[model samples]
Target: MEKTLVLIKPDAFEAHHVGDIIKMYEGIGLRIAAMKLLQMDERLASIHYAEHIGRPYYEPLVSFMTSGPIVAMVLMGEDAIHRVRELHGKTNPAEAADGTIRKLYATDGRKNAVHASDSPESANREIHIFFNETEIYD
Candidate 1:
């Protein structure tokens, strides 16, 4: 089984859509390997999004992420990385498909509901950012 990291962004958390998002994943047979609700500090957000550090959206992205508590989780299942990203849809909710999580709950590009690891390598790295050995279940 593949394991991927997912982040229920602050906007979605503030809007109370965590259940809906999690259900969508579980509904598809993805297992929640690890989960937690916590506020992200600037340092961690920086580390999580390090690749996008100099991009135009980086500043506001960090600010929004650190603004409130977020739901961080590790989802495990076949093709979990790709599946979760597909479920999350486009970065901009406006461009997301009709049945996607972003389409249903996202407010805008900045607040586009969720984040998922883009690849297997990224999945392993991202999962470690928020979860430890004891935090995840087989």
Candidate 2:
């Protein structure tokens, strides 16, 4: 089965939508293999967003992510990475589809309510960054 990393960002947590979001994923048949709620430190934020390090919105984006507790999870299923992204909708809420998570909860690009790994390699890396070997189950 394919595995993917999913982050229910601080915005969603603050809005009390974590359960709703998890339910949505479960409704779609994706298994929640592992999960945790934690506040991200600056160092972890930097590592998680390493690729966007030098971008204009990088610092603010990191700050937003670290602002509150977030739900980090590993979802397993066929094409999990792609499936989760589709469920999340586009990166920008303004452009997201009507029924997508982002469209329903996100206010903008920077405040987009969730994050999902875009590829298998990223999924592996992100899943490791947040979860240990025993956290994930088949």
Candidate 3:
């Protein structure tokens, strides 16, 4: 099974949508291999979003991420990365499809409800960032 990382952002966590989000993924047959709630510090955020460092949205994104606690989970299933990203929908809620997580819970593009690894490489990299082998389960 492929493993991907999903982040229930601060906005969604604070809005009490974490249960609904997890249910949605579970309903789609994704299994949670590992999970945790954490408050991302600046260093972590910087490391997580290193590619976006010079972009205009970088600073705001980091600030928002560090503003509250977030749930980071490792979900395992066939095509997990693609599946998670599809469910997450477009970054802008206004542009997301109906029934998608972002469409249902995001306040805006910047505060989109969740973040998922976009590819196998990203998934592997991100999963390691949040969890070690001992933390995952079959």
Candidate 4:
């Protein structure tokens, strides 16, 4: 089975959409290998978004991420990385499809409700950032 990382961002968490989002994933047959609710600090945020460092939007992105608690999850299934991204929809909610998570919950492009690893390598790296070997379940 493949595993992917998904984050219910601060905006979505603050709006209390955590269960609804998880339900969407589960509805597609993805299993939760691990999950947590935590407040992201700058250090963690920087590490998670390392590639985006020095970009124009990096600072604000980090700031928003650290602003509140987030739900971090490791979802397992076939083609999990791609599946999660499809469920998450476009980065801009206005451009997302009608049934996508972003279309249903996002407030704006930046606060677009969710984040998912875009590739297999990204899924592995991101899952490690929030979960260790002991945290994941079969």
Which candidate, 2 or 4, has the higher TM-score? 4
State which candidate has the highest TM-score.
4
- Put down candidate 3 lDDT per residue, 74-115, tens digits, no spaces: 999998888888999999999999999999999999899899
| Tens digits of lDDT, candidate 2, 1-116 | 99999999999999999999999999899999999989999999999999889999898888898899999999999989888999999989999998899999998887888999
Tens digit of per-residue lDDT, candidate 1, span 1-138: 999999999999999999999999999999999999999999999999999999998999999999999999999999888899899889998899999999999989888889999999999899998989889998
When sorted by TM-score, best at the front, the candidate numbers are: 4, 3, 2, 1
Cα-lDDT of candidate 2 = 0.93
Q: Which candidate, 2 or 3, would have the higher lDDT against the true structure?
A: 3
Alpha-carbon TM-score of each model against the true structure: 0.97, 0.97, 0.98, 0.98
- lDDT of each prediction vs. the true structure? 0.93, 0.93, 0.94, 0.95
How much lDDT does candidate 3 score? 0.94
- Compared with the true structure, model 2 gives a TM-score of 0.97
Misplaced by over 4 Å in model 2 are none
Q: RMSD for each model, in Å, please?
A: 0.8, 0.8, 0.7, 0.6
- lDDT accuracy of residue 136 in candidate 1: 96
Clashing pairs in model 2, backbone N/Cα/C closer than 3 A: none
The positional error of residue 95 in candidate 3, measured at the CA in angstroms, is: 0.9
State the local distance difference test value for candidate 4: 0.95
Worst 10 residues of 4 by lDDT: 79-88
Q: For candidate 3, list the clashing residue pairs, or say none.
A: none
